[model samples]
Structure formats: C-alpha cells, structure tokens
Target: MTPSTAEHPQMSVEDFEDLARHAPETVTLEFINGKLEVKPVPDGDHVTIFMWLLRQCMQARPDLDLHPEQGLKVGTYRNGRARPDGALGPVGHFAGQGEWADPAGVLMVVEVTSHDSGTDRRDRVEKRDGYAEAGLPVYLLIDRDADAVVVHSAPRDGRYAEITAYAYGATVTLPAPLGITLETEGLKDYSL
Candidate 1:
C-alpha cells in the first residue's frame, strides 16, 4: 500500500504550491508520503559544498544542466515533491507541460548532510526508499562533518543494495549519465 498525506499532516501539494507562489521565502517544502514537509534551510557549509560539487559536475559535462535545490514531482504523480540538493536531468524544459521534472528522465539526485541528528537517517533511509520508488538511478550523499561521500545504487525491489562510501581526499565517481567526480580534500575548508 502507498503512504498517504495523513502520514505527514502538516502540509500538502496544493498548500505547498500556494506557499511557493505566494510566499516562497517562508520555507522549503518537500513531500513525503503524500504530505508536504518543510526542509531545513541549508547552512553556509552546505552552500559551499553544493556549489563546489555543482561546479565539478558542470566542468566535467558541459552538455547537461545541473541545478541546485530544484523541486521535483515524483512518479508522474502530483502527490510527491522533492527538492534535491543537486538535481541533474536532460537539458530541456519538461516535455509537453513545461512543468515539474521528469522523474524517469533524471540521471541523478544528491543530498548534502544536515547537522540535525535525524537528518542523516531521513536522507539515508526515508529518502533512499523514496528515490528508489521513483526509479532514480543514482543518489549521492555528502557528509560534510565526516568530509566524505556516500553513493547508493542498484535500486531493486524498492531499495538499494549497493552503497559505497568515500572519505576525505578520495575521488568519488558518480554513476552513469552523470559521470562526474567529486574532490573531497577541499571540503574540510568549508565553514559552518
């Protein structure tokens, strides 16, 4: 059975869109199990790593467009909304509609770690299942505190079986369609 909006009662897609349209500065929204929830605003460290990683991906592949913190509609269904820290897909507007991202068309989704205790678990577990359900081929996790990267792949049966972790100074190569590599050594210089 699929989860419903009741699972997270605080928000809904319509409510979120209203906020996005009327009050975008209020908070960042993410839909989890059919309900909308606010995501924590990224800190300075988060921005530093995000921009650096974006640059890395852009430099390696000049053809694709990589966006930082772009909202997405999952499963061709309006119930799911996700704002990947970094989202990469085809280089064009949405087909036919010129709206929400094409889930099946995307190559990868990335999330940077949060200092909140529950942040890692949510991104690693809840979001892992969420992304897999959407058939996103690759998910990358950037843990700034640890100065490492975690790459999850092979989404089978609504879960990923392969997870590779890279520590500081290591070069992490992204999976197919992305073909980007992240440099870890410089991440330590990022301020909170």
Candidate 2:
C-alpha cells in the first residue's frame, strides 16, 4: 500500500492548492499523504549538490532538462502534490502546465536531503513511496546525512521494486528512459 493517511486529511486538495497559491514565496509548501508539509529551503550544500547533478545530466543528455523545484501531482491516484528538487524530462515537458504538472513524461525526480528533523521520513520514505505510486520512473534521493545516493526505480504495485544505495564518489547509473550516468565524486566537495 502507498503511504497515505486517508482517515483525516488536513484539508481538501483544492483548499491546499488555494493556500499554496497565496503562500509567501519565502516558504515552499507541499501536500503529501493528505497532510500539509512545509519543505525547508535548500541550504548552500544542497544547492551545490543539485547544480552538480544538473551539470552531469546536461552533459549526458542535452536533450533533457532537469527543472529545479518543479511542482508535480504525485502519489495514489495523483491525489498528492509535491515539488521535487529536480524533475527531469524532455525539454519543455511541463510547458503551460501552471504550478502542478502531471507526472507523465517526468523521467526522474530528485530530492537532496536537507539537514532537518524530517529528512529521513519525508525525503527518504514518504517521497519515495509517493513518486513510485505516481508511476515516476525514477526517484533519486541525495541523502546528505547518510552520505549516499539512494536510487528508487522500477515501480510496480505502488512501490519501487529495486532500490540501491551508492556511497559518495560512486558512479550511479540511472536506468533507461533516463539513460544518464552520474559520477557522484563532486558530491564529496559539497559535504557540510
């Protein structure tokens, strides 16, 4: 089963969307598992790591673009919404889809762990399950605290059938549809 608390949703999706629209730009908001989530802003280390991935991805597939902080409709039946750190897909894949875009054509989603109390549960687990359920082909989690990159792929039955963790400086290969390779060595330099 997907990670969700259907019993008591904090508010309707519409209400959350409305609130998100009016929210101050300084804060990022997300709705996952029927609960409101305030995503912590990315720190300098986090920013550098994502930019490193962006460079690698661009070099491998200039045809694709890794959009940062792209809002996506995710989770069971697309009921949940999230703004992954990066959403990689064909250039302009999200064109004209204001705010939240459907997960279709989104090859991979990225989340760089922030130094916060919720990093483990929010990024490593809940987001993983949600992206898998959304049928997103890949969910790449840069686990800063663990000093590893966790790749979640092959979604089937609302879960990733294969999960692999690679230590920093390892060569991580993102599977097909997104046939891009990553050399995580640069990640070490950004370590806090």
Best by lDDT: 2
Worst 10 residues of 2 by lDDT: 1-10
Global CA lDDT computed for model 2:
0.91
In terms of TM-score, the best-performing candidate is 2
- Model 2 lDDT tens row, 1-192: 544474467888899899999999999999988889999988888898999999999999999999999999998878888999999999989999999999999999999999999988889888889999999999999999888999999999999999999999999889988878899988888776
Off by over 4 Å in 2: 1-4
Candidate 1 lDDT at 121 equals 55
TM-score of each: 0.82, 0.96
Worst 10 residues of 1 by lDDT: 93-102
